[model samples]
Target: MARRGKKKGRPVSGWLVFDKPVGMGSTEAVSKIKWLFKADKAGHAGTLDPLASGMLPIALGEATKTVPYVMDGAKIYRFTIAWGEARSTDDLEGHVTATSDRRPSEADIRALLPDYTGLIMQVPPQFSAVKIAGERAYDIAREGEIVDIPAREVEIGRLDLLDCPDENSAVFEIECGKGTYVRSLARDMGRDLGCHGHIAVLRRVEVDPFVADDLVTLEALEAAAAEARPQGEPGEDGRIVDTRPDKERFAALDALVVDTGAALDCLPEVAVSDDAAQRIRLGNPVIIRGRDAPVEASEAYATARGRLVAIGAVEAGMFKPKRVFTGR
Candidate 1:
């Protein structure tokens, strides 16, 4: 008699962090990784400019459902400012709009840097993706029409002067929350010192739970891809049978994909018994046993049919359904 068999399932879902390479858009990288892993879904948590590189988190499969949770996490970057010149895009990508003949001392820049260390209003660059009138501001700027963008509040938690390479150049590290623009920060720094400034180089060192040392280069990824191919697979165009599988393809995929549980780290967890799990699964909230004392009445109850169905944690123990994961 033939042996009984079980159905095979898809790969486990998880989050992957990539040290994003320069010159590639975040969406493009996500697409390539999706193909490599043959995953049904994927998304990046944050957007990095083409000229910037570093910590990009990619959510895969069920983890893609957690994109919004991590979208507002803090980011840290190390960038250099090219003093004495300002650019249209606020970086090296655009044409120079102004230049300064004088250079300020390190002490002058240091004193000025403190002014930008807290919350302030920053005007989004005209050549930015910020939408105005249902179109990208950059698109409108490219059409030769000047765009008047209003300033928005963003917090700069920390701004430390790392080094001054020369009188015309300085490097710094910044830790800021969502929507803070380092490019604009550099521009403002220059203006305060009585000199024009533009970002010469910028690298994100960290974003929330991710760090810089964990990034892999595109070259390394390509090499790994070359080594992971199956043996004896026919080579393209009758070339040597180089069947080494492309590990980088999967590596890139792995870097951006995250597990659903990992993605929900921000939320408080409440362990449910088998009965409670069943009730919650069936759209009914069961009263939870052994819950802590209630502090905030609003968060203490999960209602069903005008009655308290489940007792939730008062302050931080409230059972908020982030994303429901039903296995991989």
Candidate 2:
């Protein structure tokens, strides 16, 4: 048998709350972090457009398993809708599809808000990630083809007018559930208010258990990596080789990591014994004890000795592992 090759990067795991700047794609940001941290595996919980800037939760190593939880959480976005013109992509990134000399009054915009609130059917923009016959909508749109993207239900918890920066732009803050498209909101609002609209600026401020304040900028991460003193001595070749990410080498970088369990904070936690944790880690169900323990929970996580064991459900006083965790 042939010997397997060693993995390229360190087995680092945690959520890096990145404050992604506009013009940097989410995939590029994740790739940058993976390189700077030298992590073995990395993924982001949500995708932020290059034109959008805000809290982007990135998962490294085992933390990737918890991404779905973060994705399903409610998100808050502060967006500025530029009235008088609708774009092909429904944002400033696309070509102008329609134009209107009329702009909406604050009262008119707020009056339309009531209709958008709660659950409503929404059509994603033509330039979007939605798949059409296995092809992305945006890809087709780039080829000068407009496909009819189906309308689906999305929950808008609240929509508030923050300010009218000017007659051409209106700033709004929206609290929405998963899959809500801010660009669509801008487009729809513009149409309903008798003025064409598109997104001028979009900033995501919150995802459950994460806020913009928790974010570490990419520049800061790079600067920390540059400033980190090499903790290893030079080899016979006079080159430092021990570049593992530990407190001694990249303490500043490592300190920015949020635990994987933190992403599951929105889910109810089921406390289990060390013995139960061991069983859970082995993919076995164990009896969950505690008067406070829920008799049943659709989705929850198990913790033992203050460390994450697995993500699963509590049923009939038992914890059944769905996704197991190997690290804290």
Candidate 3:
């Protein structure tokens, strides 16, 4: 028998702002994009609940290195609180555990927003990805186990009651830091208002450096790929294959993928010399002189000739390459 050949994929790198549809897990979206682009490596900055639909920033190849920075940035979510039933998971997917006939007035909801804003303690829903004893809390819950997720501090920069569509539900937008759960906010708000509620429609509008407007749907990507292909041509096996060359296909895909540097836009940038860039790539720290002497008192990205060189902390005029994008 002939030995099997290795999988063929290119070392594609960049970020794809995916407008993830409902009922699709983050992992599944990444896998589909990976196969679609034939990428050597891929990952997402944050995980969106399968029930939620919105911006899911996917990182391919070298872009994956910058995911942590994006993950730490603030997130914006616009969700609806259905104020009649409180579900076990605090979302539409879970079984209804309690019900109420009362619906809080618009004024009442506005008055309650202040309590959730700024720094507040939030207990994540039981049916969540939170870890407990080296296992997922949701997995434990599925096994008929009780999971008491602790109340952790999360920052909600802004929370506004956007619209109260009807007596059944009200829409709201929240801008929050990492670890804030929209479901918990809805559940807690309902309890405070003397009514039961759960997240009925949840959508993330923004994540760090990306906004909803930048999102590209999977269908759009598939269409672009189809457009890139020439009229069907026969292969050695006498089957029709994509006639577009690999370079053209990759170029078309690249047009949609955001450059890796865009992910570091929030970070202070330092443009280094070719010699300095070389030294940084070789695992050495170069001194930034004069105008570039003191970088911001935070992590910074160093680039050379408009290409990302290294991400590092610049302290006392020394530019150390913490993580270098060498091959790219």
Candidate 4:
């Protein structure tokens, strides 16, 4: 079995899509995986709240450079809302600030959800990580200061009512763009229903190319690591074993780090000859041939001196340096 943090002596590139467990922040998950792989550099594509879980793409090494490519993709979440109550933080973590005797009907919620399905304006919660005046809005709220965060336009591509377990509990799934906040959405939905509501539970179902089905649990990860350890290693008592190291020996370091290039699958591949590859590696601009005329105008194709620049792809036939890998 392979030993983690073995100092393999060279960098490799790849992407690790994590099914982030609830109650753990995205940064914490990244740090843990980084230590497990013994990776020098690693970063996550987006931040998931401790209350939310799912589809956190961890980019290792060179893959970190491609994070911006997937940052704008849509995200899907499955969340539950408790009707007739409002919270200070707009979620279960907050203190209940308001309550009502009225409970919205399932049909009413279904009808109301359609109004939020398309382009909508949502005011972010005051107790949020959004930066205002160079400080987190939540920090200001925690200080008992009343902060008025303005509403911003956000796209809710899809909002489907999945279940209504009771008169006061409703479940729904939403597909939205980068900045959509489920907690805020719940709060606004309460306002729309003429009653109070707050998010009781939230789970990210998908983010672009990743989904919940791909998630690996912490237990599974530990098992994998145990299986990967070298076999027949003597125990403290001189007996051979087929298990992993003690918890104290499990270093909080990444054992397998991947390069950044593997993270961004959007870049078009442009293979170049050995000479041109060397030039491109050295940051020299090379002219590429056989590129389509329309591709020349694409933003992905960086132009220098009226010629396409090589952002990442290589030229196949000649030592041409100017071919744009139009991830097309």
Q: Give me the runs in candidate 1 sitting further than 4 Å from their true place.
A: 1-12, 219-258, 278-282, 290-322
TM per prediction:
0.79, 0.93, 0.94, 0.77
Q: Who wins the lDDT comparison?
A: 2
Worst 10 residues of 2 by lDDT: 242-251
Residue-wise C-alpha lDDT for candidate 1, range 131-190, written one tens digit per residue:
998999999999988998889999999999999988889999999988888899888888
Native-referenced Cα lDDT, model 4: 0.69
For residues 1-328, write the lDDT of model 2, one tens digit per residue.
9999986776778999999999999999999999888788999988898999998999998999999989999999999999999898888888888899998888898789899999999998888889999999989989998788999999999999999978999898999999999999998988889898999999999988897768898888988888564657999999887676465676777888998899888889998888888989999999888878978998899998778889998889888999999854
Model 3, residue 85: distance off in Å is 0.6
Candidate 4's residue-wise lDDT over 1-328, tens digit each? 8767745421433467777888999889988877666556778887888988777888765556567766777889999999889999999888998888888888888888778988988888988888998999999999999888888989999999998888888999999998888999999899889789999889887776555655666666665555445467788998777465543233222232222343334544443444554565466655555464223322233333332224543333323333332121
Task: Give the CA lDDT, 0 to 100, for residue 57 in model 3.
Answer: 95
- Would you list the C-alpha lDDT of every candidate in the order shown? 0.71, 0.89, 0.88, 0.69
Alpha-carbon error at 255 in model 4, in Å? Answer: 12
Q: Which residue pairs in candidate 2 collide?
A: none
| TM-score, structure 4 vs. true | 0.77
Candidate 4 stretches greater than 4 Å from native: 1-12, 227-274, 289-294, 297-328
| TM-score, cand. 3 vs. native | 0.94
